[model samples]
Target: MAATFRRAMDALYLLCVIVGCTALVLISAIIPWAVFTRYVLNSAASWPEPLAVLLTIVLTFIGAAAAYRLNLHMNVGYFADQLPQPFRKLLELLVQILMALIALFMIVWGESLVEVTWHNTIADFPFLSVGVTYLPIPIGGLCLLLFIVERIWLGIPPDPIPAHHEVAPFE
Candidate 1:
């Protein structure tokens, strides 16, 4: 059971990475085209800028959730690390609880935000709902909540890939 759940999460993390990377690549390509069209071609393309902004939203929320699952999100851990073993453990648990609250907040508020804006459409892409663009907020929140549950229930899982390796600056 736990193994199955872990496998699902691993897949979700992979999906997030792929989507985020794709968005990044698209943004990279789109921006240059936008610049080229405006400067070199002397005819600006309107779609590129708006599309890149939308992709940035996807990248930010989805990528953040993946980072959180991997324990890669920013934190000030020096103080937490200095505590005694028992205290440290308690603090860690507290942090997780706080994170769960934050996730919940995101889910609830994000959904409301989506609902409120569902009828509205983007100026650049009239077919695209503003709410659709906001889907990542709640989706990322849900992913974060699941990861938190996994942490509390099973403890942190081993990273599928090593997080870091030593590299010489010029070698």
Candidate 2:
């Protein structure tokens, strides 16, 4: 069951990564074109800027969610590695707790920030709602929270290396 579930998660992450990468590539090409159009051609694309910002947020959050699932976040491993197995386990727990707290905070308070921004609706970009801009915060936060739960369930087995998994870059 665990293996099947893991496979499903890997598929989901892969799907999300593909979506994020495609969005980033398409949106990235637009900014330069938008710049050229406005400065060189004296014309503007109506949907480019707002769409770019929205796509950028979606791409970043989706990528981040996949990264969190893959254990791709930065960690201060130099000190943690020196500890004994039990100590390392304890440290991993502590770190997971910290991550959980951050996820909670993002979900709880990030809403209000977005609300205020939505209410204020900036200049020509009145359509650029803050609520939309911040949609990723809670989504990514929830995904991170779920990943931490999986990490906690998997537990720390003395070393960062998993028998099946390859060495991560920072390791």
lDDT of each: 0.90, 0.74
In model 2, which residue pairs have backbone atoms overlapping below 3 Å?
Answer: none
* TM-score against native, each model: 0.91, 0.72
Best by lDDT: 1
- For candidate 2, report its TM-score: 0.72
Error of 2 at 128 (Å): 5.7
Task: Estimate, for each residue in 1-171, the C-alpha lDDT of model 1 and write its tens digit.
Answer: 999998888898899999889999999999999999999999999999899998998899888888888888898999988999999989989988999999999899999999999999999999999999999899888988988888887788777775357434555
lDDT of 2 by residue, 1-171 (tens): 666655556576677778789889989898998898889999977767877877888887777877777667565699899999999889889988998999888777776667767666645478667676787777767766766776787642123336555646664
Residue 155 error for model 2, in Å? 4.8
Model 1 vs. true fold: TM:
0.91
Question: Which candidate comes out best when scored by TM-score?
Answer: 1
Candidate 2 regions exceeding 4 Å error are 1-8, 42-50, 114-128, 155-171
- How accurate locally is residue 165 in candidate 1, as Cα lDDT from 0 to 100? 70
